[model samples]
Target: MEKREWKVCVTGGGSFIGSYLVNKLLQKGYIVHATLRSLKDAKTGILRGFPEAKEKLVLFEADLYSPHQFEAAIQGCDFVFHVATPLNHEPGSSQYKNTVEAALAGSKTIFMSCLRSGTVKRLIYTASVLSSSPLKEDGTAFKDFVDETCWTPLNDSLSYVYHDDHHKDYTYSKTLTEKEMLSYNNNENGCGGLEVVTIPCGLIGGDTIQSFASGSIAVCLSLITGNSETYKSLKFLESLLGKVPLVHIDDVCEAHIFCMENSSMKGRFLCASSYVSIAEIAGYYIQHYPEFNVKQEYVEGKKVDVKWGSTKLCEKGFVYKYDTKKILDDTIECARRIGYL
Candidate 1:
């Protein structure tokens, strides 16, 4: 289909990454329909980033579990970016069941609706690094990188302990949800059989383009604002310092656009800038905001062990302009540019 005629719909348009995606699509001159849970919410300053987008961006109140709602949302859309997912982390959180069921059901619903409607030519699903790796094993992430194929396949004994009470449910949901998405063995062009592209992304970092941040921006801000209880203190510091892969939010958006533009790309794409150690991140922070106590102990002048990998995307010509140094530099630069510094 022609770029100008492409009518795109992004689920979770008010969200962090989704907002960016919507804005980018609109900037490229494509008609966009964005989904919100309610018209009231959308009218109440939900889509403030692109006020002009109100004309091109249609707000549809849709529920993930309700197949009918999704069917209505994707009507007449040429591409679907299924980016919405439940993110609650409470241990007894009943939201997990709803979240998982909704994601699985919502994907099927969107894909099926797209195929049946015969409108969408491609569909991109917003997946996560955790979906690929559960982190169920109690090992320090002491490595440098993690790739698309490297998923955390913990046995029954491991899923319970790999994560904490806060995020255990969330991690498990992502792992199972990704698996469920992959399990669909539909042939191309089947009803709901448009190309399914999975983006396994690492920790997203960026400032809020809007007053309200969603997805990785929220997570990064939480870490920055010390709201993330999981990555605080010495133990958390050591654990985090062990290993992680990092990506700037803008790059991730660009990747989504890139994949959409390049129709031949299929299967799993591990979106990351580079493998970064938490200690290295801490060092970067120390260079500027020294007051943030990213507590760590120096034993023999060495840091702890942590590991992640990213090779598949690299092989696919997704060049990372930012390494650890570049990431920190760009982050600080972005902060300065946006006056966060």
Candidate 2:
């Protein structure tokens, strides 16, 4: 049988992770179709990052809330990378609502459309460690290791007091979305014999901070960017110390590509190098860039304690070259490249 040209559609292609995925796919000679709110915005400046691959990057308007908008976006596409989601740490913010709703609605809509279109062969969903395992239940966060087997039961009795409706909603949405996808796997209405891969990654770190300064790694960059006073004053640094697992952006992107090529692989996977403490990362930045380092004393807050395991992905042959040390080194290089170091 002759190999078919992979036509991939990346949702939220204008955003940080999505754009990176688009670039990677385009470079590998795959025809990439990306969704944005508006091509006018993309034309204004979004393609600058991959100036050389501009021709390969096709932008379309496809809102997650609108199913009609997606027909053209996924037409003739063989793969789907659903990377778009609303982000807001503040529990009550509209951003959180939009993120939860969009992810749920948009994801399911795209999957169904792909099934109906009958062209897609595989669907790779970009999920976060947050969905697979959430720490909000214990009033504690994952300051350490987490894996695919872990599930954050927010509605459990343990969080009866603190689990607000919104928190429960977001968690429930993610859980159901993944569960529903699994349920749809072999059904006649679903992917139609298509394969699925869900990657649960931790604090996605990479060489690009300018695009997602408000995202997972941006907090780290903010702390080291002479803005430590705020993080310390709020004792946020304390909560962050020794908490949260870290993963490289490239690895996160690669795992999706790997899963796409490795058709036999199915189900959920947690992609991360290893666990590292915020304090350890802080110490590294302090040593390398004294100008950006702040006193440790100001980082006054309760110590963080959490552990998670990524052995599943590791055992599945997903070797993480960027361990904590390498991640920090690469982060610094990213800073230097962007002139933040």
Candidate 3:
């Protein structure tokens, strides 16, 4: 069979990364089965707008809360990409507990469905960097660079201790879900004889193929689109002093494809390109787009020193296509086209 005829399923196809993944898959000539939380959502329009979507794309409605809904979606898929995870960043939101619960339950549902499908050869899971490393509380550098072996020191006790902090809650949930997934992968009886690979990514940023901004792009839009309150609150001067691991969205999608096609690739792959500060990003925008009234404030806070390395991925012979400058330019251009500017 030709490459275009291969079958694959992408859970959460409506997501920022998932949507882009779907587009790339279609371009490669694969018959894509994309899942959405609701067919009426705007993402349906975005997915339908892709070239040849009518011929190559099939849509399925699935929810994390309901695993049974995914059975039909993955029935005959050669590969499965589990890219759906609930994120609630708002502090003091009532949905915080529900978000954590749904994430854990949803992962369980999908993993079991993949095993039961009996057709899935490889399952690529999209995990976050928070699962492996914790942000520095004091804003100091990590004693050493973080690699796949470094697991965040989060547990039941820490969860309770940091209960008041929503960010920590998010971190703890991701850490827990990743641990469970790994444990399931190692289980001789639980995997149902399938291969699993996890990609733990950092802050993902780039020009999205979709019409609207999502994920980290949305945050960047707020910074550049006259959101002075967001700019003032970010404390870019102090926070930018610390190293932040970032990966382009396209790089992230390529990482997923690389893992899916390479049978030997397994375990956790850190998908970050470089560490940069907020000030550098701001400077790029100001220098390139002088017409926009960008905020230039420098507030010195505790210096943060955190580093996440992707040496393992590099050794696997996967090269990143976008650097910091390219990422900024592409992201800004996309934002402007989408009218976020």
Candidate 4:
């Protein structure tokens, strides 16, 4: 089938990775059905500005909590990209529970929709590195490297023990969602012959077409904009997490497209470039943009070793287009252009 004749659905098409993926799809002449939580979201305006968006892109309103809402958006699509997952950073608010519920329900809803669609041949799920096995479990760090075979240990007891840590909750949600998705796929009657491929990505950073920065990019922007409160919160969290594996936004978008086109691609693929600590990122900003008054402080703590392997992705003939340095540079440039710097 011609690329223009192929209809694909992208959930959370206005998000950091989603926006980039939507633009790429439009450029390739694919008919894209993109979903947004609301028409009022600023991201809707940003996505509408993409090239050929008016001609090839269709916007639909869908809610993560409401699975039935996705039916209209995903029906009659050739491929489904389930990229929208909720991230709750607010520990004090009840948003964490809502976020977790949304992630799980939303995934199941999308998967079931794909099964019902009949036209969807493949479903590309954008998972997180957190969904994979932990670098540290039960207060003891694992000595081995994390690969596709590793699954994050879901300990309800441990989850309650670390209830104060919001990251743990988020991680649990992703792990459960991924596990359920895979389990559903394995059930011949459940997936209806629809192929599911999960891409567990690391700390996604780099230029985004969205009006606002989110995820790791938001953390970077906090430092760039000299937001002390935000910086302190992120610094504390990063200190506990250690040097996270970094993945360029563009590289991640490319991985989505590559997975869609490559029929042989199956299972989980790690989409990350390299590892860099939060302190190292601060140091880079301080050195490059001294006027920003970027603070650099080494948090004295046992850094969790993030030695996750991405050799499987590389072996699949996928090459990273951006390194750590390039990622930082591109991010700063984009932030400046967008007046966030």
Candidate 5:
């Protein structure tokens, strides 16, 4: 199909990844029905200013809780990029039960809307790599590597009892949401045509629209910012997954496009170009950005490497544009440019 003839719907169009995807789609000549919680957002302004956006892009107001609200956005679109996820981001905001309920319910509604949208041929979902690992039922680490086959165990033993409340919730959110989204493909009822492709990306950080300092970027820059709490979370994740799996936001956006354009792709594909330790990250900062006080303590020399970043996407011909150094460089540059540095 010609790119110009395709009407694509991108949920969470104002989000870190969604805005970039919106811009990429516009540049590629795809008519985008970009959905946000509100029409009058700062990100929407930037989106509207993109070249050809005036003619090719349309904005719609939608929220996860209301399934009907998504209908207008997905209405005649040939493809859907289901990126908007329910996340509090702030620490200690609510009870864990509420968080899980909201995540699963919102995710189900979005998937159901996509299935209900008869015109949608494919739905490219943004799954998180955090959804994997805690491999054993007894809360152990991954001995070999992580991949699409490795799902995070959520049955009370590990993930549910994780010490960090926020971490536990986020992991379960992605794991449960992914399982729910992919399960619809086997629907025996009248709703089974929507092809679902999940690109589970690790820590996403890179160029971002102004005023939108993403949580991923913040996590990546925790060492620089001296945010011990966020840095602790990263270390815990590293110990649990046994690797510093990460990828630039641009690569993530590119993967989304690649999954949508290529017809043969299916199931889940994990994305990450960098797998280094906190010491490795600190080393880079110490060399190039010595002016800032980079936390040297992260070089604890207790690193655990794992093979979580799957090469499945590359095997299917998708190439990455950024490495660990480049991912850090772009993330730092973008963060500085946006005054978040």
Candidate 6:
């Protein structure tokens, strides 16, 4: 059968990354089965505007709270992109337990659904680099650089500790979810093993299809908007990796497609286009749009340098197209179009 005739399911199809992935798959002529947590969002209607979407695309409502909810969407699909995550609640909130449970249960449910389908050859998960720590096991010092080989050390404060311990709750949740995603390899469910691949991406920037700007895009825009609270994202990322690691949402979506096409690839692939200082990012923002009066204080030396490398993805012949400037450009343009600016 031709590539265009294959069926692929993308969960969280209305999200920042999922929306782009769904559109790209459609553009490449594949029949896309996309899932959103709810069908009531008026914004998701734009998905149907894509080329040939009326005939080639289908949308389903699936949420992690309900196990087996994704069965209808995953049935007979050749590939599945598990892009939805259950971190919508604040880490310390009362719903935190439900958040964690949903992640584990939802991930297990997706894996089983794919195995039972008997048609899915690959499952690509949307992962985050925040789950990885660049430090040594003892947390005494930084490693040479973070790569696909790096794992968040066991019982590390940021890795496992939660519930009023620290503000790394979201990071910890993602760490657990990613590990659960990889644990399904060679699972003992009788069916042939399902091939799983994950892309642990950096702070994702660039355009989005949603009616509103995504959290990541909003944080980047904070540099000029004077929203100091949003700096927590940078501080958290920098403290963990020793630098700000960034990648365009477009590049991230492309890497997912790259992994799906290269069936032999396995394990986690670290996806980052630039590893730089917050000061550097501030300078670039000022250079491109000085009228915003980018704060110079953010450029002061705030941390040391520890590289987050994408050598694995690059070695797999995946090339990154957007740099820091292009990411900001696309993000700003989209934000303005959506009235977030």
In candidate 2, position 15 carries an lDDT of 75
lDDT of candidate 6 vs native? Answer: 0.81
lDDT of 2 by residue, 87-109 (tens): 43334544335555666666778
Q: In model 1, what is the error at residue 74, expressed in angstroms?
A: 1.0
lDDT of 3 by residue, 223-323 (tens): 47756544432333123213456678999999899888775556788888877666666666678877875677421223456565559888988999998
Worst 10 residues of 2 by lDDT: 233-242
Candidate 2: where is the Cα deviation over 4 Å? 1-4, 42-44, 48-55, 88-98, 134-145, 156-176, 186-190, 209-214, 226-242, 298-307, 339-341
Report lDDT (Cα) of residue 156, candidate 3: 41
Sort all candidates by TM-score, best to worst. 5, 6, 4, 3, 1, 2
TM-score of 5: 0.92
Query: Across residues 132-159, which tens digit of lDDT does each residue of candidate 6 receive?
Result: 7777777677787888777766464434
Give candidate 6 misplaced runs (Cα > 4 Å). Answer: 90-96, 154-167, 186-191
The 10-residue segment with the lowest total lDDT in model 3: 232-241
Tell me the deviation in Å of residue 187 in model 6: 3.9
lDDT tens readout by residue for model 1, 239-295: 433445678777788788777777565677878776655555665666666665544
Query: Using lDDT as the measure, what is the rank order of every candidate, best first?
Result: 6, 5, 4, 3, 2, 1
Any runs in candidate 4 off by more than 4 Å, and if so which? 88-97, 156-165, 188-190, 221-242, 299-306
lDDT of 5 at 21: 93
lDDT-wise, the better of 3 and 5 is 5
What is each predicted model's overall lDDT from 0 to 1?
0.63, 0.64, 0.73, 0.76, 0.80, 0.81
lDDT (tens digit, per residue) of candidate 5 on 262-285: 865568888888777778888888
Off by over 4 Å in 5: 89-97, 159-163
Our model 5 lands, by Cα RMSD against the true structure, at 2.8
lDDT of model 6 at residue 313?
88
Q: Relative to the unseen true structure, what is the Cα RMSD of model 1?
A: 4.3
